[model samples]
Target: MQLTNLNMPVASLLACGNDPGVMTTEQAHAAMQLHLDCTVDRCLVRRRARTTLVEAGKCVLDDQAERL
Candidate 1:
């Protein structure tokens, strides 16, 4: 997805910045046009968001397992 097409608000990135379950630096850079890391393969931020969600789900499952 194009950077402009993601349509995520700037506040969302700010809120998610400290969360490990959020997007990688590359994705965040793409989101806010910060150009923090330009060496990564140009991937759509939306795809990264989806991948982050999947990883976050796995983390939750792992935590639940520890609690059981």
Candidate 2:
């Protein structure tokens, strides 16, 4: 079940740094199929919290509420 050979567009999407939100249903299906084939024991995908520069400690914002 090695999906390395599967025709998944995941690598291209990842390279562009764009979220997979724009992917079509067919593309999503292809990616899912690839993932299922390649998964070892268990696999999970979770969304991390979206943070701003101030929250990330990269800057001190006077209007933190606005950023949030």
Candidate 3:
């Protein structure tokens, strides 16, 4: 699993300065943490999606008649 790809957006948001919302450093850190956490959640969701697709494909193949 490539965690770095998932973290790129979080890192970019953290590196940005001059927040339009006037967020403090602490607030920014918290927001970045939240983003990282959400990214992890998304990765898990993607993994599950892939697993389901593979399982469905296998099921379809299993139900098909053998070709000579």
TM for every model, in the order presented, reads 0.25, 0.29, 0.25
| Per-residue lDDT value at 53 in model 1 | 43
Locate the minimum summed-lDDT window of 10 residues in model 2.
Answer: 44-53
Ranked candidates (TM-score, high to low): 2, 1, 3
lDDT of 3 by residue, 1-68 (tens): 23343433434344333232433333334444444544423343322323333454531223332220
Compared with the true structure, all predictions reach lDDT values of: 0.42, 0.36, 0.36
Tens digits of per-residue lDDT for model 2, 21-64: 44333444444454443331232210111222234454343665
**Which residue pairs collide, candidate 2?**
none
Best by lDDT: 1
**For residues 1-68, could you state the per-residue lDDT of candidate 1 as single tens digits?**
45544455544543323232367544544543442342123433433443454465622335543342
Model 2 misplacement above 4 A? 1-10, 13-21, 37-68
Question: Model 1: residues >4 Å from true position, as ranges?
Answer: 1-43, 58-68
Once superposed on the true structure, which residue ranges of model 3 sit more than 4 Å away at CA?
Answer: 1-20, 37-68
Residue 4 alpha-carbon offset, candidate 3, angstroms: 30
